[model samples]
Target chain A: MLIIGEKINSTRQRINRALISKDSHYIQQVAVDQVANGAQVLDVNCGINIKNEPELMSWLVRIVQEKVKVSLVIDSPNPDALEAGLKVHQGSAIVNSITAEKNRYEKILPLVKKYQAKVIALTIDEKGMPRTARERFDLAKKLVKVTAEHGIPAKDVYIDSLVHPVSTEPQQVTEFLEALRLIKTLPDVQTICGLSNVSFGLPNRSLLNATFVAMVLCSGLDAAIIDPTDKSIRSAIKAAEALLNRDQYCASYIAAHRESKL
Target chain B: MIDPKQIAENLINGQAPKVKELVEQALKDGLTPGQILKEGLIEGMNVVGTRFKANEFYIPEVLVAARAMHAGMDILKPLLAKSGDKPTVKFMIGTVKGDLHDIGKNLVGMMMEGAGFEVIDVGIDVSPEKFVEAVKEKKPHVVGMSALLTTTMPSIKTSIEALKSAGVRDKTKILIGGAPITENFAQEVGADGYAPDAASAVDKARELLQQR
Candidate 1:
């Protein structure tokens, strides 16, 4: 699975305080820490309330890129902020989101094509969050079609079958898994989600999140946004990958154990 | 008659909107606000808390249930205030000095609030002096401190000392928690109690109040 580290977001109070204080060293440390913990990609969000988002996004991109060579997921709801990060990014980055809402494709797809970046398409539209698997599949299909029209390859698009908090709707996990299975049937389109969303508002969230990584693998999910530094999550991911036959002879798993021991 | 039991069931299921609607409906049906609050919302959260203690409900479930309970509380708070009904239990909480990790702390505060405590949140990276000041002003029944980093765990001890110096150590129960904190460490730091997670924190607060 592609592990996108999620610790740098401004939603986190520490990161938010750090960003507000222009604490570059703190930001750099978090960036380095996430990469060191096995994140292949880092998800950066400037949070929702910060003013001067475009500038902050650019600054964050520069600082993180300075400390690490891992690919970035420039996460934002604003097209201008996405463009700002793209301008500063040294390589092909992933646009963390664009929904199926009308006018989103027109605003964000151009940036993806111009920058040659992958995009995460949220399975939501003007009608609001899709409550059923059929709605999710239909929205994901629309996302693939729209991005393809923008000259982006099918593989460059990641369908995020949004995970609703299961406590609110008991069937939410099942609905999301079913949606992911349907989205996987699309030609070459990848599927991903913020795996933590499923366990939101619950106790012992890490256990639930770790279990979700294993479940999503069977549902054709190729990536997740999570705290890669969490040992339980890391162990679960390694074990799940091994159990699923993705870790070839358990070489990586054995190596991981050996490294931890040392 | 609007069934308050239905509200409790909805809250346990994490149905915030439904809980809100049902609470409004119950009020419209002339059910006492106190009855709706205690028997309906608090009763539901008690079940959630019990399930959480048993590891049957995880963080997400507790959060959603808390949110659902909050929906009912939002309706009752103003009415309760007008009627001059204050929560019997009070707690002041913060992440320890140099520790900006508050997700765990916030969870504990929410659970405490759901259990009918008046929680005064001091936010993250709170200094010892600041904690002393809050203790003096808030005069809470309990004080809770959280630290996620091992390096910052000593702040719990330092803050407790500050409380002792301020002549308020015996006035309240001091509880400590976080990723790195343990019951042994809590003893070393002279804290009255330690809860590994948010659910137990609520129960601990209740027990501390009983001791008081």
Candidate 2:
């Protein structure tokens, strides 16, 4: 599974404040925590709230990458910001997202192709985020198809089936699952989630999120926006994968356990 | 001609129309809209949540299910409202100041409403003073604050401090949360409670009310 450390993003208040203030120390600390905790890929979204964004993202990317060896997930809503980010990354990175919107695809895909980076694809369009699961799923299919036509393989794309909370819409959980199942049925299309999204409002959220991770693994999710530092979640994934037969004889789990001295 | 179960399945599969069709059919078949909502739509969501917690569902499936549930809710809201059924709880929520992120806050608000709470949302970039103002005006039993950044986490502390200083902190139990917040942090802030995510927030709120 692809663990995209979401900690490096500037959307979080500390990161945003740090970016606005140009606090390299703070940025480096977050990058360090995300990697040491276990993020295979660090999503660097320099989207500062109430601060400078483009230059900040670039500056952050440079500093955060130095703190860890994990591949970067260059995250930005703006195409220009993404492009700017790509110029600084040392190796193949993952572009945090792409929607089916014509402008998004037109603006972003070239950079993906240029850097040979993977991408997180959202199933929405210029009209905005769809209100229904089918709308989002169908949008994903179309986005995958269109992007594929541009020589970007579907395998290089990670589909984010935006999960809303169950307490609201109630069916959001089910709808996102259906979309995931369908995506799994597709050839070469990978699946991920902004894992934090599922627990958006409930209490003891990590428990629910950990449980949700198991579910996503069941539905063939290949990546996630998550905190690798959380042991409950990481351990849950290992156990779930073993149950799903994704882990051959639980070798990886055993190895991880031994590494942790557990 | 749509089966409610099929609608439930489709909703889980992210087919909103199918769920709506089933809801309408259930309604036309003399089933109370509330019955269709609780049995067909809400019940399906519960299953999705349980499944999600068990690792049997993924984000796409969960989202599609939410969409499907929404399609059905659209048909039931007026009917449910007209029926005069009392909502389960009342809540006020927002993301802490210096933070513009709202998806998590919105999700929590939506879920609280879904879980039967009448949610009063203050939206993003909110200060503790705003929280105090909302509490003074709405008098909700619980106030939920969200922060997506660690730097803004201090703002959560500041909000709690503001709540305490306003002397209204006792009037409304403050529930602090966000990606960076820990239970330890919540206690340090003098908040009445802390929840890590939207769904657990509902459970915790319920637990808090029960304790009170």
Say which candidate scores most in lDDT.
1
* i-RMS, each model, one decimal: 11.3, 8.8
- What's the distance in Å from true for residue B161, model 2? 32
Give a tens-digit lDDT track for model 2, residues B43-105: 676667666655566544666677777898888889988988646567999988867667678
lDDT of 1 by residue, A1-262 (tens): 8999999987576887788787989999999998999999999887433357789889999999999998899988678889999998988899978888768778999999999999999887766678789999999999999999899999999999888666556787899899989989999999989977677656788898889888998788898899989888888888888888988999888989999911
lDDT of 2 at B84: 80
TM-score of each: 0.61, 0.58
Could you give candidate 2's per-residue lDDT for residues A177-252 as a string of tens digits?
A: 8788887877998888987767754567789889999998898889888888888888888888888999899898
Q: C-alpha displacement of B42 in model 1, angstroms?
A: 7.5
Give residue A166's lDDT in candidate 2 (0 to 100).
56
Candidate 2, which segments miss by more than 4 Å at Cα?
Answer: A49-51, A131-133, A260-262, B1-212
Q: Comparing to the true complex, what docking class would candidate 1 get? A: incorrect
Q: Chain A TM-scores, all candidates?
A: 0.97, 0.92
Assess each model's interface with DockQ, reporting 2 decimals per model: 0.15, 0.04
**How high is the lDDT of residue B53 in model 1?**
78
